[model samples]
Target: MGNGAKAQQRRERGGKDAGKGGKSQLKVNEASKSIVCGTCRQSFMTTARAPALTAHAEKHSKALADCFPDFKV
Candidate 1:
């Protein structure tokens, strides 16, 4: 794929470790770092991988936006 296509793909999957300045706010150390549910504003523990944080997202919605492979922008 060309650079444009790769960039679009990265933007579509802008989660942890995807690339620089991703949509995910997940972090490993600080408790202050966490991701919030867009619908409810609920807070979830920050994690680099989706499995660690996918449960709560799954509870409210099927798609794990900014947490898993699901894209949220």
Candidate 2:
């Protein structure tokens, strides 16, 4: 294939990968850090991988709320 064709192919593949649920997977490069939700006082871990972090945060919220009814934020 010509160089231009190869480049186009690579771009297309990259776009497809990005279109997938790339947000859910945890990226290895970013450090894990705590995130404080503005809506709640509870803190949760966040990472470069927003999808995984969001999932973890939601789980934390549910567990905390279930364990303590009075839990706020």
Candidate 3:
């Protein structure tokens, strides 16, 4: 199967895009020690690195506030 099929399956199972691309959607998983992209369910192993995480967030058209509202970016 292709990636599209897998994505469809994830949608059917209500797994992917579960965060709706809003606040708290992008957060660090302490246990896993990774930054998870709630919009696409993609994970980054850089371990909550701000610059890397910010770069990824840009792909979702999200501003710094979406990732961290209290942050002074």
Question: How close is each model in CA RMSD to the real structure?
Answer: 17.8, 11.9, 16.1
Most lDDT-accurate candidate: 3
Tens-place lDDT digits, model 1, residues 1-73? 8999999898788775556555564444457646666666665544445664566667766667643433223
Question: How does each model score on lDDT?
Answer: 0.59, 0.52, 0.64
- Looking at candidate 3, the ten consecutive residues that score lowest on lDDT are 25-34
On residues 1-73, what C-alpha lDDT tens digit does candidate 3 reach at each position? 9999999888989966686766652354444644456677665564455777788779889964575443332
Name the runs in model 3 displaced over 4 angstroms: 1-33, 46-48, 64-73
lDDT tens digits, residue span 10-70, model 2: 9887895766664553543233535554445554444324454456457667543343343
For candidate 3, list the clashing residue pairs, or say none.
none
Candidate 2 deviant stretches above 4 angstroms: 16-73
Q: Could you tell me every candidate's TM-score relative to the true structure?
A: 0.35, 0.22, 0.39
Could you give the candidate ranking by lDDT, starting with the highest?
3, 1, 2
User: Any idea what lDDT model 3 has?
Assistant: 0.64
* lDDT over C-alpha atoms for residue 47 of model 2: 34
How close to the true structure is residue 67 of candidate 1, measured as C-alpha lDDT? 37
